[model samples]
Target: MKKTFFSFLTFFIFSFSAFAQNSVADEIKTLSKNKWQWMADKDVDKLDKLFDEQAMFVHMGGSWGKTREIEIIKSGFIHYKKADIHEVFSPIIIDNTVILLNRITLLAVVGTNEVSNPFMVTEVYVKVNNEWKMGSLSFSKLMGLN
Candidate 1:
C-alpha cells in the first residue's frame, strides 16, 4: 500500500509540473505572435505594454533600447510590414524567463524601399508581477544556401 501510494504521488507531481511548463510556453507563444501583429500595425500603445521598460532590440543594422525602438516604430523608420512565420520552436523556460525561437520571413520598409528577408528571431521574455514582458528581441539573417 505504501509503495503504491508513493508512486502515484510522484507521478501526479511530475505530470502537474509538465502541464505548467506547457501552459507557460503556449501563453508566451501567443504573446509573441500578437507582438508581431502589433508591430506590423504600428500599435505603439500595445507594443509599449508588451515591452519591458529596459528592453533591448537587436537588428542586422544596429541595436537600441525600448524607447528608441518605440520611436523608430512610430516614425516608420523601419516599418514591419509583415512577418511570415514559417515555424515557432518550443520555448525554453528557466524560472521566470522564457526564450522563444521563430523562423520567419520579414517584410519591412526601410527608407524609400521595401524588402523581405529570412531570419531567425529570438525573443526573450521575463515574468514580472505575473505578466510576461519582452526583455529582448534579436533578429539574425539566414544565409541562402542557393
Candidate 2:
C-alpha cells in the first residue's frame, strides 16, 4: 500500500509540473509575439510597459541592458521585417517564472543590408503583481554550419 501511494503521488506531482510549464511557455510565446509587433511599430511606450524596470537584455553583438535596446530602436539602427518565430524548444519553468530558450530565424535589415540568420535566445518572465513581466532576455547568434 505504501509503495503504491508513493508512486501515485510522484506521478501526480510530475504531471502537474509538466502542465504548469507548458502553460507558462504558451504565455511567454504570446507576450513575445506581441512585443515583437510593438518593436516593429516603433511603439516605445508599449515596449517599456512590457519590460520590467530591472530587466536585463543581452543582445547579440555583445550589447546589453534595456536602455541600449531602446536606443537601437530610437536610433533606427536596426529593423525587423518579415519576422517569423518557429521551432521553439527547451522551455523551463521555475516557481512563477518561465524561461524560453529557442532558435529564431528572421529577416532583418540593419541600416541598408538585409540579413537572415538563426539565433538562440533565452527570454525570462516573472510574475509581478499578478502579471507576468519580462525580466531578462538574451540572444546570441548561432554560428558554424548552415
Candidate 3:
C-alpha cells in the first residue's frame, strides 16, 4: 500500500508542476503580444509598468536603459507604428526568468523616415515581487525582408 501511494503522489506532483509551468508560459506569451500593441500605440504608461527599472533596450541606432527607451517612445523618436509578428516561439523559463523570441516585420518612423524591416526580437522577463517585468529587449535586423 505504501509503495503505491508514494508512486501516485510523485506522479501527481510532477503533473501539477508541468501544468503550472505551461500556465506561466501562456501568460508570458499573452504579455508579449500586449507589449507589441502598447509599443505601436506609444502607450508609455503601460510600458513603464511592464518594464523593469533596470531594463535594457538594444536597437539598430544604439543600446539604452529603461529611461532612455521610455523617452524615445514618448518623444516619437522611433515610433513603432506596427509590428507584423510572424512567429513567437515558446518561452523558456529558468528560475524566475523567461526568455522569448519573436520574429516580426516592423514598420516604424525614425525621425522623418518611415521604414519597414524584418527583425528577430529577443525579450527577457524576470519575475519580481510575483509580477513579471521585462528586463531586456534586443532587435536583430534580418535580410531578405519583404
Candidate 4:
C-alpha cells in the first residue's frame, strides 16, 4: 500500500510540474506576439506596462535602456512596421526568468529608408510582483542563409 501511494504521489507531482511549465511557456509566447504588434502600432502605454523599468533593448544600430527605446518608438525613429515571425521556440525558464527565441523577417522604416531583414530575436522576461515583465530584447541579423 505504501509503495503504491508513493508512486502515485510522485507521478502526480511530476505531471503537475510539466503542466505548469507548459502553461507558462504558452503565456509567454502569446505575450511576445502581442508585444510585436504593440511596437508596430507605437502603443507606448501598453509597452510601458510590459517593459521593466531597467529593461534593455539591443539593435544593430545600438543598444539602449527602456527610456530610449520608448523615445525612439514615440519619435518614429525606427518604426517596427512588421515582424514576420517564422518561428517561436519553446521558452526556457530558469527560476523566475524566461528566455524565448524567435526567428523572424523584420520590416522597419529607419529614418527615410524602409528595410527588411531576417533576424533571430532573443527576449528575456522576469517575474516581478507576480507579473511578467520584459527584461531584455536583442536582435541578431541572420547572415546570408536567409
Candidate 3 per-residue lDDT over residues 68-117, each given as its tens digit: 99999999999999999999999999989999999999999999999999
The candidate scoring highest on lDDT is 4
What is candidate 1's lDDT per residue for 1-146, written digit by digit as tens?
99999999999999999999999999999999999999999999999999999999999999999999999999999999999999999999999999999999999998778999999999999999999999999999999911
Give the clashing pairs for model 4: none
Best by TM-score: 4
TM-score against truth, every candidate:
0.97, 0.76, 0.96, 0.98
lDDT of 4: 0.97
**Ten-residue stretch with the least lDDT total in model 4:** 137-146
Model 2, span 35-91: residue lDDT tens? 778877778788877788788887566656677777776776777664567667766
lDDT-best of 3 and 4: 4
Residue 48, candidate 2: alpha-carbon lDDT? 79
Worst 10 residues of 2 by lDDT: 82-91
Model 3: runs farther than 4 Å from truth? none
Prediction 2 global C-alpha lDDT: 0.77
* Candidate 1 segments whose C-alpha is farther than 4 A from its true place: none
lDDT of 3 at 99: 98
TM-score of 1: 0.97
